[model samples]
Target: MPGEITRFVLKISLILAVFGASAPVLAEDMLVIAHRGASGERPEHTLAAYELAIDQGADYVEPDLVVTKDLVLVARHENELSDTTDVGSREEFADRRRSKTIDGRLVSGWFAEDFTLAELRTLRAKERLPGIRPANTRYDGLYQVPTFAEIVQLVRAKEAETGRTIGLYPELKHPTFLLQDAGIDSVDLLVTALREAGLDGADAAVFVQCFEVGPLRRLDRLVDVKLVQLVNTNDGPADEPAMRYGDMVSPSGLAEIADYADAVGVNMNLLFGPEGIPSGLASDAQEAGLAVHAWTLRKENAYLPPVLRRGTAENGTGDVLGMVTILEAQGIDGVFTDDPGLVVSALAQ
Candidate 1:
């Protein structure tokens, strides 16, 4: 009987050697990332929005970073400030408006690159989706655009204050556009700021993300923090020389991405099939040793999958919890949502 017990132990040891002792515990808890800092409740990319998101129990808060004329890294969804700020109504800055081609499209607006950081401070944030969330309109024009350094400082202070680790997920928006139009390297500015704050290492509570592969590849070399390569389903314009986001989901493409990125941020549709069930994309990414974080899970019906949407009204409610459950089952590592409170509550259950 002793010999039999010894043999059993040997077998267990061999199995553990082959599979690794912690293999069974490798599964990560699904994270709730505040898409632009509980953006459903407050104007995005503002200090108030980020503070509100921390209060609501988000694991991370995302700030899409754009550069100003003076090379200051600021948080804004896009360099164009027409939609998310009151810049359009500012008569003093009306001359700043100009039509320029960005990302293969001609857009007329007050670009962030055209304004100095001090000039930008004169503008205030507004509700980007006031039609769906009219209540947010009341808080519009109350908050100022926050700098990347300011956001990092806020998160660090919050961590010390709350005793809970809060992470920052900042995306390099329109990298190609910034390079071509403004002749500024967004990644360099971002890395410099992070390094100054002592948040440039692999263990730092930060994730630098970008849609364009060029910037992310460059960032991978510049910073030690984790990087996420965002994947979109849309094809690039014919004249655009960049690779289409659709191609990045292929097995070979994912393997290539794993070479530089720690994770892949995909559109929710990439994870679903024609039947609206979870697809093999998540598993494929897992096979490539890449974490998957899906994006933009909003409460409004228009933003949800057809089957999950509740009422006919565009702004009506939807089965956000149901959608989240499906993604969790698909082995998603994190979810980006405008309503972080709802996602946090759903995950707890």
Candidate 2:
């Protein structure tokens, strides 16, 4: 979404020069944003998970926002109803299973937009990454996806109860495509919800992120809260047939985005590039005046780096140290990990 002009000199900064010694000290103060609440400890997007995240010391608890059929705001990864729920097992709604191109993929499943908020709450949350969270399944059917309003209510109440400011980070998932297909996009609704809850303002502790730039731009035109443009070079918008996300990460691409958004949430791989670990994007990202936040950090070996794998001295039995390593080395403003406890522990150490 850069304008017609683009420029890049690759003037990477030298923050990493003293990083070796600074790693321990920096880890103590790094901002930790819970990926989907304390997902490492509870079902994601459920109020329980988010509440635990705050109790565990998350600077912000994230919720991916979506709208239901009744126009109420709910939380879910994709509007998809299959992977995260028992929607497929319900014979009554079995006919609801179908396919549609969401953000350009022929995805077929029961989608969130197809249900009302009331209906959604009747369903329970499942481990989206069961391979990494088999233990989490013990609590399966224990929690339900919560509404943005519910989260706002909880966070405000927590701020009062704990005397600590806890922020909310929301990603306006697939906004443009939602409008193009489902006739339901939640940015306006989300902004309105924030205002109604007294959480929308320059001083509001909120950060909104999205992979697509169009919605962020549109949201900027609507409200004055912080916004982030998420990037994924591997399978992002650019890779989509009719998508242009690939163009969004380039120097010119990012500069254009910096115009409308407050920061960028690039995939961890992009921060480390194809090389992985020991490397960070502090210099390049800093040049853009954009704060970098990486996502989906977890303790599972699948999500952990080889050197920082489970049970290693460098990373312990969890994913925090390895990730915090990258966070410090790269001078990242924050990160989204399932284990806010681990993140908080790492920060304290």
Which lDDT tens digits does candidate 1 get at residues 76-191?
A: 99999999999999999989899988877799999999999999999999999989988899998899999988998899899999999999999998888888778988888888
lDDT of 2 by residue, 206-225 (tens): 99998776678778888888
Please provide the root mean square deviation of candidate 1 (C-alpha atoms, Å). Answer: 9.0
lDDT (CA) per prediction: 0.85, 0.74
Off by over 4 Å in 1: 1-27, 236-242
Residue 184 alpha-carbon offset, candidate 1, angstroms = 1.3
Model 1 clashing residue pairs (backbone): none
Q: Which candidate ranks first by TM-score, i.e. highest?
A: 1
Q: Let me know the TM-score candidate 1 reaches against the reference structure.
A: 0.90
Estimate the overall C-alpha local distance difference test score of candidate 1. 0.85
